[model samples]
Target: GESVGLHLPTLSVQEGDNSIINCAYSNSASDYFIWYKQESGKGPQFIIDIRSNMDKRQGQRVTVLLNKTVKHLSLQIAATQPGDSAVYFCAENESGGGADGLTFGKGTHLIIQP
Candidate 1:
């Protein structure tokens, strides 16, 4: 069966260092990709997003990379801080701007090591 999900369960990074979180998606039909951050006791918050047409996109301190050939996606965080410690998730939308909700990955727990 096809699967769309994150590749790692957790990632530990030192403060001020860069962090990379990986995800794998199965549905090539997915056109939109979004990365979200979820702190403990809080809902997922949007971080960055990229469309399937592009292979990479950058935000303030973050970058989203997509590899359609292998169906992989990655989020890179520059200068990871303690506040950046949270569960990160990758979501995909295949409905092509339709009303259907996105399908989210399991999520990767990002821990900032002091």
Candidate 2:
């Protein structure tokens, strides 16, 4: 799985509000998914992940939902903060891609408003 990237404008949210980022993929055979957050200069960091067998998984302040029926994925951030400002990416691993098989898709730029 290779990373192919494009972006959809930007999302602006208040510092204490909630944020939901969505991603859609065309691969129906994808069996694993991950949500990553990339700050200005750092590498992509793992935020949350969900396997094809499940629909939703949650982390400290984040949640990942996967809908295989429509090949859609989303990340929900509760109580957004200034630290939440970054580019988020959704990566998919095909059925047989294994642990190292992850392909990144469209990234959403999140801007925190005052």
Candidate 3:
């Protein structure tokens, strides 16, 4: 289950164009960061993940960047397709706190335009 602790936001991008989704997390102690993509009526699917020790990580055509200094995170998707349209959100786990300590951010709806 996902947490709806804040207002939902939206981002629209054109098909074949690169899309960048930004997230700002508040837990300075968080050691792990994850990006999730959720289609309507479905569970959140893992996109990519990063750790406090690393500044960036990439998966397939997706990239995740974590800036602990500013407590910021962002996901970049290359050549987005219609299938890429979904609700994307970021989750973080406090240092030493495993999956059980995961905190979700307010999600943003990604819209792909052809």
Model 3, 27-79: lDDT tens digits are 67778889899999999999988989999999999999888897888889999
Residue 70 of model 3, lDDT score:
78
Name the best candidate (by lDDT): 1
Residue 22, model 1, lDDT: 98
Clash totals, every prediction: 0, 0, 0
Tens digits of lDDT, candidate 2, 1-114: 344343464899999999999888776677888999999989999998899999999999998888888778889999999999999999888775444668888689999999
All models: lDDT?
0.91, 0.85, 0.84
Candidate 3: where is the Cα deviation over 4 Å?
A: 1-8, 97-99
Q: How many clashes show up in model 2?
A: 0
Q: After superposing candidate 1 on the true structure, give the runs of residues whose Cα lies further than 4 Å from its correct spot.
A: 96-99
Rank order (by lDDT, best first): 1, 2, 3
> Which residue pairs show backbone clashes in model 2?
none
Over 1-114, each residue of candidate 1 has an lDDT whose tens digit, in order, gives 344698889999899999999999888788889999999999999999999899999999999999999999999999999999999999888865543788888999999999
Q: lDDT (0-100) at residue 24 of candidate 3?
A: 80
Tell me the alpha-carbon RMSD of every candidate: 1.8, 2.5, 3.3
Which regions of candidate 2 deviate over 4 angstroms? 1-7, 97-100
